[model samples]
Target: MTPPPPPNLLHDAFSADFEHELRFTRSVLDSSNPLLEDLLGWDEQGPRPGLIAVVDSGLHDATPGLSKAIEARFADPALPELRETIIVPGGETAKNDSNVVESVLSAIDLNRIDRRSLVAVFGGGAVIDAVGFAASTAHRGVRLVRFASTVLAQLDAAIGVKNGINRFGKKNFVGCFDVPVAVICDEAMLETLSDRDWRSGYSEAVKIACLKDAPFFDLIEKNADRIRERDIDASRPVIHRCAELHLHHITRGGDPFERAEARPLDFGHWAAHRLESITDFETTHGEAVSIGIALDTMYSHLAGRIERSQADRVVEVLRRLGLPVHHSALHGEAILNGIEEFREHLGGRLTITLLDDIGRPVDAHEVDPEVIARAADLLA
Candidate 1:
């Protein structure tokens, strides 16, 4: 494998910084197999070095196929030892599934593997999140790679090195930052997604557009039909673009590893995270986030924090994406209680990303309870 063009010269320079000393890359799964070569810096050396572990939710066939693909690529007997490969299953349930993480870690032996070994997470956001958190904690740290199979994973969860697992009924209550050595985005993997999964993932893509780029929002509007139909050709660019947007916000400024000064871009996450915990992991993260975005926008409008038009627009886009915009399943009281829980989860003082206008965010330190009540009323 030829050495990856010097890190500083890559097209996505921002990614270089996100990975720290680690490397990052994205490619269509069925396309060329340069990722292994690039990652290992192996030319004619036969097999690349590294213990590869593949984590999948087992809900889809893509995960096993991904592992097979990696194995096939490095099958040459003359190459360096490819080390052992472990496959673990569990999806959203795995986010809080410590047993699965422990199983993966035990297979790799935390004390045995070093930075040279690689933990390749090849599944949806939940699987990636679980394995990533495990890898970050194992042996202090090790090389990590993510092959985000779901749209939500690719667009939002997988890029950031924020590895975490749920605990005490709270989402991401345990975790650390362990950026992947590289990322392989196989758009083909998306074909295996259920319609519900697709819609859930698209909700996140919509959030990114609503918070950062109007043109991106417009693109989604225009291609909504094709995207919903699962048009790989049309959806690939959209997925890549959304991931780029997330990467931009995460590495914008300040320390990438530390969670400090919540940006307005984290708009709905405050409620979204809590809702997930309250629902006992029943609600999809994207579904919770969709409701959170709508509720947050409603709060912004009722508080005179943003225009009613802006709130309506947010609802429109979310509805168009086939996402839930109402908190009807959750009572106003529950939502309020959830808000308090969310704040406590964040150690008090909720940080919300409110829109001054569409695509414009302002960090709000203290959110009024009255505003939350009004927002809940609107959703109800």
Candidate 2:
């Protein structure tokens, strides 16, 4: 009777604000650059907060002087005190192994990386994702400064507010959304990438262009050769514009944390993620994404959402950039599971982004396996 007398329950809502910052420069570790120092300026925490450096092992191996650079940069009296420089596995290994996360957390605990202190992470997308996860979870959270060293990291992964590691054989299955203190993209780092890694990053550029900007797509299409050849002059614009477009979508698109159903930025990610898992990561994310874009573009054509010529153009661009357009795994039933898995990830009805035309993306409620088979056939 007392419960009945009570008028149901009280309901309320609250909101919080966050700031996301990104910078593009060369030699941020150089003594002349004030960007890193300014970002890490004195706060109530301390005049010189502790900083733990977690670097990608692959990057450390690839770039001969990189370890020396990190040591030199953090040794400066003006910046945060260098706690220790820890080298973790790079690429998918960083995200796949639980030990990577533990090692980072262990380092944080050992070094006492508090919320006010900093975890300056240097690596590609995977290492950043994993290290960021460890940093965010330690003592609730810690200030993180990302040195995005790879093309993919600079253009897409590092700038995002989300971070995570793979789990249960799923890509990014374990992760959280947390903004970093700063995301610094040093273009000089791209010069260290191999031919394959260099080519891998452009697929993301192609992906963003297809979803939101026709002119950007055209620009990428036009400069495919120079980009493939590792011409920084030709590639920098694509990387910058892609980063800007992604940042805009995350902020202005009104769903930075993906609390809703639709995920427009994931234009072809369903198939892409599936392909990566199915291939046991033999197919790189960028290459898998290239294949995903091709598969979905053709599906759009079959669904009458876009013209055949437009779909062909998407495939053509991916190929010109030296990315894969198809994988044998797409024909398997495992690939079909991504639709439901994706829906679960989003926590609602299926919402896949398909293109009505370049620069015009529409959410698809569901995908047909037969139609997907047809798309795969076309790619073949």
TM-scores, each model vs. reference: 0.85, 0.96
Where does candidate 1 clash, by residue pair? Answer: 1-42, 1-43, 46-79, 47-79, 47-80, 264-353
- Per lDDT, the best of the predicted structures is 2
With candidate 1 superimposed using the best TM-score fit, by how many Å does residue 107's alpha carbon deviate from the native? 1.1
Error of 1 at 238 (Å): 2.3
Give each model's clash number.
Answer: 6, 0
lDDT of each: 0.70, 0.90
Model 1 earns a TM-score of: 0.85
Best by TM-score: 2
The C-alpha local distance difference test score for the whole of candidate 2 amounts to: 0.90
Tell me the tens digit of each residue's lDDT in model 2 across 1-380.
34557677898999888888999999888878888778876655556789989999988998888778878977877778888999999899999999999998999999988887899999999999999999888888988999999999999999899999998988999999999999999988888888888888888899999998999999999999898998889999999999999899887889999888888878889999988999899888889889989999999999989999988999999999999999998999999988888888888789999989988888889788999999999999
